[model samples]
Every structure is written in C-alpha cells, then in structure tokens.
Target: MQYRHLTAYALLSLSIGLSACSTAPLNLPAPHATETQSLLHLEDQFHLNNLATHFPDPLAITPEMKAFVKQHVPESLPEVGRLRYLTEALRNPRTFGISYHSGLTLTAAETFEQKHGNCISLTVLFIALAKEAKLNAWVNEVVENQDQELLADNRIAVYKHINAVVQLPNKQVVVDFSDLGDAYLRPQQRIPETRAAAQYYSNRGVDMLGENQLGLAYQYFKRALQLDTGTSYIWGNLGTLLNRMELYTEAEIAFREAYSLDNNDHTALGNLERLYLNSGKKSEAKQIRQVIVRRQLNNPYWHYGIAKQAFEEGKTEDALRSALRAIRLDNSEYRFYYFAAQIYRELGDRDNYHKFGIKAAMMRKAAQDAE
Candidate 1:
C-alpha cells in the first residue's frame, strides 16, 4: 500500500448537469476547461497480462429481458399507463420477476437471468423492463452525504443511491428497492443516464481493486470518469487508487478535486488530512478533522461510523452497542442491518444474524415492491 507519486500535470474538470433535458454522454463533448488535462486515455491506465473479462456494457438490453416483459405484461396496456401496470406486475412472485442479490455490479441481462440483485442492479433491471414496456425510464440517484460503506478486502464503497424513475404522461413514479417510508430521507437528485452508468462502473472497479486487479480497476475507473467526471467520489476513488500505488502528489490533487466537487465528501477530506499530517501540515490536518468532528456530531450516521471503527478494533460489545445506537438514531438505514449482522456474527449468535439478515432483505424487498 505504497502511496506518494501521483501528481496531475493538469486536470480537465467536467461540470455537473441536472435538468429536465439531460443529454447522453456519447454526444457529450470532451471537457477542455483547462489548458492541459491529465492523460485520461484507457491505454495509459491499463496494461493487464490477463484481460480476459471485459467491462460490462451498461446500456445493454437483451431480447430475453424484453420478451420477459411482453410475456408478463398485457400487450394492450395503454401506452401512457404501462409503467404503472408493470410496477404492480413486478410485485407478484408468480409473474417471474426480480429478487434481491447483494454485492457487485451486474448488468440488466445478468440480473434478468439471475432473478435478483441489489438496489443498483435491481434498478437497472427495473428500468430496462420499464423501457421495454415503452415507458420513459432512467436511474435516479438520491443526493447522499456521509453515507459510505467499508467493504471487505480493504475496499471502500461510497454510496450513491439509485432507484428507478419512470416518466409518465400524467405522473412520474419512483421505484425503490429499499423503501424507507417516513424515515429520515434525503431529497433525490436524478442523475443523467451516463452518470448512473459511471457509478455502476466505478463500484465494480472498487470490487476489482479489492481483488488486487489493478489493471482492470484502472480501466473501470477511467471509464467511469470519462462518462461523468463531475462525480466527486469517482475522483476520490481514483485518488485512493493512486495512493495505493504511492502516487501521493497525484492522489492529493485528486482528493482535493473530489472535496471541491462535494464539500460533504469526508472520505476525501480524511485522505487529504492524512496526507497533510504526514507532510507536516499539522494545522491543516487538524482543521479538516475538526470540521468532520463538528459535522459528525449532528450526523445520524456518526454512530454507525463509530461502530465500524469499534468493530475494526475487535471490541465486540462496543461495536454492538454503537450499531444499536445508530439504529436508535435512524432505524430505516439498511447499513445498520449490516452492522447488526456483523455484531451478531462476532457474538456467535447465528440465529440473530439470520433474523437481522432476513429483516434487511425484507426491508429491501419492500422498497423494490414500493410498498
């Protein structure tokens, strides 16, 4: 985990776009906001000896997916209301549709074949079905802050929540796989399709990096940034990757760009703080840490973050208590379920682990069912 050599010669920062008329990334012009840009070519980032598996195509819509929708949905469904009918149709198990599969990025085709996936994968699945039914559909991402997950294998997955948004002539409906009703909720900001695709690829890259597949991960991250460079976390991920390679200068720049893009990105702030602390910038490091402490005091997720730290420290009881406290602060957050599962595992309470696992599954299902 050597880090201290990555410095961008220059950077091309892409502007964030969110409007009623969002455009396609393919048609998007290369952003040249600066005189020089970092070498963003895929070849520069990838040099794998074994490049057997290619990246999954995000826009893929297979015939199987379309035909499945046709077989279940009535052909005579009025064009304007197809989205609503399909939504109801998905809720029935007899209709031969979606189930929940956790982890990784699966394409619509893979999800359709597998019959289940996590919210991100499920949303892609649902949106594909909606599009086949002739309804306008796209992935909708909710604005998230201080919502990050520390996954297995030293990998961190920043949460950029996704749900299906189907546009109707009369109304628009949101299809969520993690229904958090009347719970503490955040206002959603729908991302363009390309941005959504970028998120998927970025997450897949995270998993790949966890596997130590640096070459493939680099490719994935490049593609993600190419699709939507405005994503702060994606840049942060790139910075983290560079850090692992000991590209500290480049990593610092990347992290700062991430924080600049989104002030709430404590991950970037934390990383920057570490860099500054190591570089003898004690005051700068402490200032960032203080900001985080002040913010976390009011953030409901503060307890969960503490719980994660406790779990890592091998303090079972403290972890469990903190995890529970997080739930007490906000019961609707699914991350708490994950923490509780970890605690139960540590306590060797298989029954409680299974119970909480089932509870989490059901909560996700209720969201998918939009119940």
Candidate 2:
C-alpha cells in the first residue's frame, strides 16, 4: 500500500471548510503588529529554549549527498537532461530508491542513509539533490485533495503531500515520491525553502505531540511559526498543543487565527467546535457544526462515512441515501460505488446491486490504469 486507503469505519474525510465571515462568539483580532510579540511572549512565558539552531537542516547537501549527485547527474548534460537523469536515478532501485516511511521525518542525509522517510523527508532529499545537481527545483505544496487518516487517539492525521518541481523553459517536471496517482495529487503552489523547512519543524512538533512531549512540541510549533507564520496548519497544531495544556483562551485565539488564514481549514474549524463544546457553549458549538455540515455537503467522503455507519447499524434505507449522495458528489471514488452495491444487495434490489457492482469494478480498474 504505497498510498493510504480507508477500510470500513474509515472516513475518507476531506478538510471541512467553514465560512471565515461567519460570526463567532470570540472577539479575536486578525494577526497583526503584535503577532510576533505575542509569539515571543509565549516562548518567554513558557521558559522554552530556541532550539532551531540545533535542529538538522532538511535541505543541507552533505558530503555523501554531493557524491551521490555527482555520480548520477552528468555535468555535460543540459539542465533538463540533468534533472531527468537525477529523478530517474533516484527512483531506480539499483541506484537509490527511498521507501515510504510514515511518521519518521528525516533530513536529506538521514533519508539517504536509511533509504526511508515520509513525504517531507523525501521532498527535502530531492530538493537537496537537485541543488547539488544545479537544477531549479523546489518544494510544491499540494493544496487540494489532501489524504488523511484517523489516529488511535481519535485525532485526524492529515497528510500534506508535497513534491519537488523542476521548472524548465518548455515543460515542468514534478518529482513525486508517493504512490498517489494524478487523481489524488495536484500541486497548488511552489513554496520557498524557508516554508519547506518550517514544514520539517511542524512535522517534528506533531511527532512530539503524539508522544506526549508537551514542552518539546511547544518549542517545535513555536519554531515552525517563527519560520512561516502564514501556514494555517502550524497555527492549528499550536492550538491543539495549547488545548492539551488547558490554555483555553490562547487555544481559541490560535484556532481563530488558523481559520482566518484559511477559511477552508476543516481541522481548525473542528478544533474550534470541540473547544466550544468542551467549554459548554452548546449554542456556539451547534452553530459551528451547522457551518461544517453546510461546507461538507460538497465532500463525498463525509456522505460515504454516514452511509457506512448507517449500513453497519442495519439502516439499509438510510445507508442507500447517503451512499447515493456520495456517488453524486464524486463518482470517481470506487469505494462509494462498492458501498452502494452492498446497500442494494441488503435491500434485495438485485438489478441495482449488479449495476453498482459492475460500476465499482470499472471505476477501480480505471483508477489503477490512471496510476
């Protein structure tokens, strides 16, 4: 399984978008002049040390990295040719292929040694190699179609799939390390190296958060915000950390800031809803949930989840309704059609069952062919 997939009870959930203009119970200001000061104060107040200097540089081209690049990328080749050679060399199992490793985010050098890293480490390694090879390559953020899974702690782990891009005069070459097909990946924008580095820090923060290292996670999130304050996910992660520490007011402010940056960030919206519910603001929580439902009406995965749950509970009619809605939202997902077939089978609708069953099979085959 090169690409992550959802089994039963799985929510093929996309990030829910809430209206940024929606009225909120909290009077939070947009990030402004005092933003840096507030961030610094948080660091000072927590008595945390600035450890960015000690962290490994994800894009640093080590001696071994340089040697690998020199051996693979020919100096005589044109820029495009060199890029092609380097990409091919990296993916060739005989040369240097990196296996997909979740949760472990390594630097370029570490990834080279271990031959295993998540998407972030792989992207960093590619950028490093491209730098040594003198190719114009950098990290491109995939804005839409983010892959996510539910963690054991009931937190959603959103996979921010990033890949490297080489811009040529005629065509652009994308170096994707993941097995996700074109249907699942669409590069939105090219981010600067600093933001890419911030991603490394944020990933570490998430790892620390998962391991219950509160202090360490705080520092990492702070470091990430210091590097790139525009990224909503980092702010949302900081909010999560603060919420865990019982800093409700600060967490609410952080979550609001995250929502302000990206109105479509469902995670931030969901976090805000949770905070509201925990604080016993039932009215506010209900309002936020309504907004989430309105936004998620366009998300097929949410409907699929409802369908799956209803089916498991023996409500075949309700399951069929949600399943059909899922298909209407996104017919490309074979799982939706497959689930619909199951519902139809349970209802004794043999004709529709066979119809959906055939469609599911065809969709699956088409998806495989695209890959």
Number of the predicted model whose lDDT against the real structure is largest: 2
- Candidate 1 deviant stretches above 4 angstroms: 1-36, 39-55, 79-81, 88-91, 147-155, 179-185, 278-283, 298-300, 303-371
Model 2 regions more than 4 Å off = 1-37, 49-53, 145-154, 183-187, 305-321, 330-371
Q: Residue 328 deviation, candidate 2, in Å?
A: 2.0
TM-score attained by model 2: 0.78
Q: Encode model 2's per-residue lDDT on 1-371: one tens digit a residue.
A: 13221111111112343344444454334655465336435755455655343677778878988999899999899998898788778778899875777757788888888887888888888888888988888887766433222211124655566777887878777776666555233435888989988888888887887798877888878777788888877888888888888888787778878878877667777888888889998887777777776756667776777677678889999989988998898887778889899999999999999999999889878765754
Task: Quote the positional error of residue 2 for candidate 1 in Å.
Answer: 43
Q: What's the TM-score of every candidate structure?
A: 0.68, 0.78
Please state the error at residue 200 of candidate 2 in Å.
1.5
C-alpha lDDT of all candidate models, in order = 0.65, 0.72
What's model 2's overall lDDT?
Answer: 0.72
